[model samples]
Target chain A: MKTYIAKRLLGAIPTLIFISMIVFVVIQLPPGDIVTSPLDRMQSQGVELSSEAIQNLRAQYNLDQPLPLQYLSWITNFVTGDMGYSYLFNRPVNELVGERIGYTLLITLSALLFTWAVAIPAGVYSAVRQYSLGDYALTTVMLVGLATPSFLLALIVMYFGYEWFGISIGGLFSPEYRDAPWSLARAGDFLSHLWIPMVVVGLGGTASTMRILRANLLDELNKPYVITARAKGVKPLKLLVKYPLRIAINPFISTIGFLLPTLISGEAIVSIVLNLPTTGPALVQALINQDMYLAGSFLMLLTILTIVGMLISDLLLAWADPRIRYE
Target chain B: MSELKSQDAIESDNILQVRNLAVEFHTETGRTKALQGVSFDVPRGQVTAIIGESGSGKSVTASAIMRLIQPPGRVTAGSIDFAPSGSEPYDVLALVDKDSRLEQLRGDHISMVFQEPMTALAPVYTVGNQVAEAILCHREVSKKVAWDEAANMLQRVGIDDLQRRMQQYPFEFSGGMRQRVVIAMALVCQPDLLICDEPTTALDVTIQAEILTLIRQLKGELNNSVLFITHDIGVVAQLADHVVVMQGGRVLEAGTVRQVLKQPMHPYSKGLMAAIPGLAPKGQRLATVASVVGATDITTAYPLTRLADGRQISLSPSQLKAFGHE
Candidate 1:
């Protein structure tokens, strides 16, 4: 297992390098550079800037270098932990991302837990009691949850949280706890406001997850081995779990590669509506304003997460199923 | 005919007595009777083979006895009285809660070997785990004890390499080996009655003969009754002590294998026996059940046949006299 992980980690180097190049090229694709956008904004603000000043700004930002040279320097600095300066935020990209990544992970992880906790059982139940009343009802509700746009759900949840419950549901913390240092009370406040975006984001995933699991499990429920288990006098629930459910969960584990990127860059629209401080909104803002270093860094982090996620999923699948071997 | 056999004899000699068994399947279109008034006796320490063509309720009878008929298919009517060794006879259909008493009966008193051995064992589990699970499901034994018994059972079923083979999954084994594992699982608990639903049907012809021999050898040593379901008359000739012939969910003829084979009373049974491939000369049109048994009557004459060598022969009057019928 250790050797497999080592091999996978080594293999990810080329993939990460390739993704970094794509991220750079995509960030550079919007017809204007970081210097051009902000300088144009400055000119529109009636600030008098000479051509030499523009040239100096371009040189300072390394925009005057050849594309490959700029990529080499940017990648080298990124590899060495220097994420470059974000002209829009007027701060280093590292510091800008560091402040929000924790909160983003906290929400995403909890929402993921919520998704599996709810989806797996619901999926199993729906499959076991397929065509029953509870199955029909659960399917209807999950379908509605899937169809309703997450941002719209977030707005509705926020409205209800404020109107009915009299709780401020927007953002990660209350007014008092927004800038307060870490404390139990502040943590409690943070949790109190985390559920809005968590549910809004998690519900959609839960719906799809339940459907996939239900379909997979339904296929397995009647397989010969399941009947063999049943004939062995295994209790119904035990038989379901040990035989069919074990096989049914394979697809779920295989999908974990996509979850890592989702963890860092959560539902952007939902985050924007809920006013939560997460990497999703930061990445979106950087992209819109063409903040090259910040946007490029965020995309690179997502790319790395995807690779790491795939590795983790492969390891997990190998662990869960004996048939899956990595040699 | 079963009524003529004294109840006392059946009570003492039979492990399972299925009487007036009826099963129905309710699908979207309408209801279909899968088994109707089907009855048979699996005498103790003997193989009772239910012979029928496909859809003849042979498997349904086995499933009904095991209480394995699921939704849309139900035991609509019947009394399946199973009298396992040293246990009081009880009506299997009378068990109200399918989970409690029925659970104890299955894999404990009565175990089943299904038709498709390739798919019968769970692929995700090791051969030992699946076999041991049968022991553990009934008896409250330590995992080690159950596993050891599983290994022993696997060895008994002709599987070698106790350490390596037990740990291997079903996919690693060939079809014949997997069926052996399945048999080991069913017999691990020393079930009084092993319901084999075409256990050898999915295997190759050579493997099928070996499995049949294994089943008989095990039955003799273990002193357990086997309720074997199959459409193969050849298999019946090899293994069965008593034979029950069925057609369209109803029993047509049932008697000792010698009686059923030598002097089949039912035209359907005659038709079935005549339909055996090798019975007809090579290159001749095989006699199907419909051909021997008239569409609306049982009095159809047995046809004369031209042999592969171009010679023709018919059942002589003396041969018909030996059958004691025209």
Candidate 2:
């Protein structure tokens, strides 16, 4: 197992590097730089625009350097655990990204747990009550979840929140609690705003997960071992839980690789509709303003997240299924 | 007919009495009749072999007795009466609506060993856990006690290193070893009647002989009645005291092994006897006895005779009839 983990860690190096290169190139290929947008806004404020001032600004931010040299310096700093300053926010990139990573992980993980907890039981019940009215009802609900897009769901949730409870959707925390210290109260306040996005993002994913788990459960239920269990006079519920559920859940756990990426993209849409101060909107804003460093860092973070999710899923697969050999 | 003795004096008391049992499968195309008017008695403390070809309704008969048939297939008629030792006879067909009563009988009074041991045992659980699960289902024993009983059962089935084998999964064992594990599980509760459905057909010849020997030894030790199902007449000769030969869901002939093998009355039974390899020597060119049985249309240049006792008999020209040629 140690050897297997070492091999996996070794394999991740080239993947991270390749991802970094693509993020770097794609963020730089845009038409405008970060300074251009801010400078245009400043000019509208009747400030005198001077070429020398622009040059000084560019030099201070290291934007005047060649793209290759800039990338080399950025890569070296990234490897050393030092993400440079964000040109748009005028703050250290690590601190800015770190604050948002917590929020992203909070919503994503909650949504993941919610999806599994809801889908597994529903899927199994649907399979057990196959062709019955209960099964038909669950199938109808799953179809509705699939038909309604996440963005539209988020919009509907936001409208309901606003009308029913008079809640604000401008950001994750209320205005009074925005800069509060990280405590349970502040965290609870933050989570109140997180519920809508989590539900919206989790609905579509839960439907797909239910469909997959239902198919898997049905297949395992038909296996001869299950029949053997029944012939042993095992109770139907115990047979379903102890034998079929364990084998069937392994395949769904391995599907976490695809599920994680879907969650991230779904979060992006949810954040946009609800105006949460999450990485989704931040990444979009950086791209639109051509903030190469910020955009590249965010993209790299997403790529790293994807790789980590896949690695975790593989490890989980090995843990859940003893038949799988990592070698 | 007087020459054929009833042999009721040698027959053990009946344990299970199945009468007019029929099974039908309700498929999308239509209902398919799988079993038709199958009636037989499984005697106590004796082995009764049900011999037939594939799709001859032998397995279906055993499954119906256990009440294990799934949806789209059901026992449509008749009764399966179970009379346990010192207990009143209860009709199993009447308990279809009362599941608790049926549940009380299965795994405690009756247990079954299926074909293909590789699939009969769960792949994910340890062999010990699977057996313990079976024991605990019918008994109120603690887990530890159940597990110890399971280990003992494994030892009884001739598995060496019982402790180690108990911890292993089904895939870790060979076909013969897996069947032994299955036998251990089936006999753990000391069921009054054990149903084995072609238990050795999936095994190689050597393993098949060993399994048959193991079953015979176990049957002697337990003195429990066994309803063994198989198509191999050789296995029947080695294991069964009494045999019922079935064709197209009907009992073609039934008698003791000696009576059935040496003096088969049914034409289908004679055909089956003639088909057995080595019954006739190589290059002697065994006579094809296809005309007596109408299911297959193979032509034969021979005649079938109606004996004075009214049983149809067919004989090969090379063989002399000890009894007058029907």
Candidate 3:
């Protein structure tokens, strides 16, 4: 097991490097550097703009360097404290991400935990009591949840919040603790409003996960081993948990690899609709502005998480399933 | 047209009495009457083999005894009066779903071993943990004690190196060995009635003989009644004290093994008996155990005779089914 983990870790190095390059190239794909848009804006607004100033701006951002050198420089500076300085925010790229990454983690992680905790039991119940009233109701509700896009749900929810409560349902707080530092009151305020975005982001995931689990568990419940366990006098709940659920949750656990990048990036459209201050919005802005290091670093973070998440899930599967031997 | 034995024929010491056991499978296609009015007695400390071909509802009958039949397949009508030796008789069919009484009855008063060892045990768990879990479910013992008892049971089943073998998963063991572990688990609780559902049909001949011998030995040691379900006449010959021949979910004839094997009264029973190779069709298989095993392998490997064999030139679909190919 240790060797297997070590081998996986070693193999991920090249994949991370490869992903890093793709993120860099893709972020760099749009013609012109960060100066292009600003220069255009300044020119169109009938303001005086200088060629030497443009040359200095280009030199400052290393736009004149070769692509590989630029990549190396960006990566190196990123390894240090620089991160190619975000001109839009007038802050370092790392600091910008660090500020918003907390909210991003909080929203996604909470939603993830909530989704699994609810999905598994709901799915198990649906399968165990298949074709019953409760099963049908849950199936119908989850189908609706799956079919409606999260942004639309968020919009409807926001509208309902405004109409019913006479208050805006946007952002992480009630505007009083917008820039407040860590404190019990601020934390409470944030949490009081946490559920909306979490629900909006999590509904689709929860619905899909529940359906998968239900199908997997349904297939496993018919397996001969379940009958053997039943023959052993194992009660319904214990038997389901012990025999079929253990095998059924394989696909769910394997989804960890897919979740890290997705959740960390945040749901872009949903975040926009809910007006949550998460890194998801910043990612798109950074790429569009050609904030090379900022965008590349964000991608790098996702890339690292994705590969590491895969490793963790693979190890977990190897541990849980005796049949899946890593060696 | 010989019929199933009447209730009067059931010995007083019978461990389980099943009557009018009718199972139905409700599917999208339609409802299938898998078993209808299947009556039998599992005499105490004796092996009663219910023999039939595939889809003969023999397995359905065994599962119905434990009420282990899954959804889509249910025991729609039946009364299995289980009167374990030294215990009061109870109407098994009266127990509702998830009833504690039924739970206690399983693994304590009754247990079951299945046909294929390949899928009989959960793959994730160690054999020892599984057996120990079975013990723990019914017994009021500590984990240590349950595990120790599991090890002892494995040893009892002729498995040497019990400590090592118990820690291993099902995939690590051969089919016969896994079956041994399964038997060990079933007998570990020392249930009065143990259902063996085609237990040796999936095994090779030598392993089959060994497993049969082991089952008999364990049955002797445990002194529990066994309901052996199988299709092989040779297997029934070696293990059964009483024989019940079934076709199309109904028992055609049943009696003491001696009486039924010597003089089958029903025409279907006679045909089944004739299929035993040396009694009739020789080279076509079923004469010897090896021939029977080979024949089953052939049918399993090739459903249609794409083989340019002259023997199958005149074969019809019904004739093919008579050979049990479909």
- Whose lDDT is greatest here? 1
Candidate 1 residue lDDT tens string, A39-65: 787889999799999899889888899
Candidate 1 local lDDT, B1-326, one digit each (tens): 01321133346777887777889999999999998766666778888888888988888888888788898898887688888777678888888765476998888888999999888888778898999999999999999999999999999999998899888888889999999998999999999888899998889999998998899889888988888888888889988888888777877667789877877756778888899997878998999899998776433332332223221113344554564534
Interface alpha-carbon RMSD, every candidate:
1.0, 1.5, 0.8
Error of 3 at B290 (Å): 22
Q: Show where candidate 3 strays beyond 4 Å.
A: A47-53, A264-266, A325-327, B1-11, B281-326
- lDDT of candidate 2 over A133-251, digit per residue (tens): 98889989988998999998888877877899898775788888998888998888877777777788888888888888888888888686887677677887788888888898988
Stretches of candidate 2 above 4 Å error? A31-69, A182-187, A325-327, B1-12, B96-99, B284-292, B296-326
* Model 2 per-residue lDDT at A307: 86
User: What is the Å distance of residue A117 in model 2 from its true position?
Assistant: 2.2
Interface RMSD of 3: 0.8
Question: Residue A89's C-alpha lDDT in candidate 2?
Answer: 80
- Indicate which candidate wins on DockQ: 3
Candidates 1 and 3 compared: the better one by DockQ is 3
Q: What is the lDDT of residue A30 in candidate 3?
A: 84
- Count clashing residue pairs per candidate: 0, 0, 3
Distance from true position, residue A9, model 1, in Å? 3.0
Fraction of real interface contacts that model 2 preserves: 0.44
What is the TM-score of candidate 2?
A: 0.88
Candidate 2 residue lDDT tens string, B1-326? 22222222222378887666779999999998887666666778889899988888999898888887877798888777788776677787788545775775677788888899988887777899999999999889999999999999999998889778888788889999999998998899898989899999899999999999999999999989999999998989989877877766655556677777788866678778887876866986665545346654222212333345433233343321546452
In the order shown, the candidates' DockQ scores are 0.65, 0.48, 0.68
Looking at model 2, the pairs that clash are none
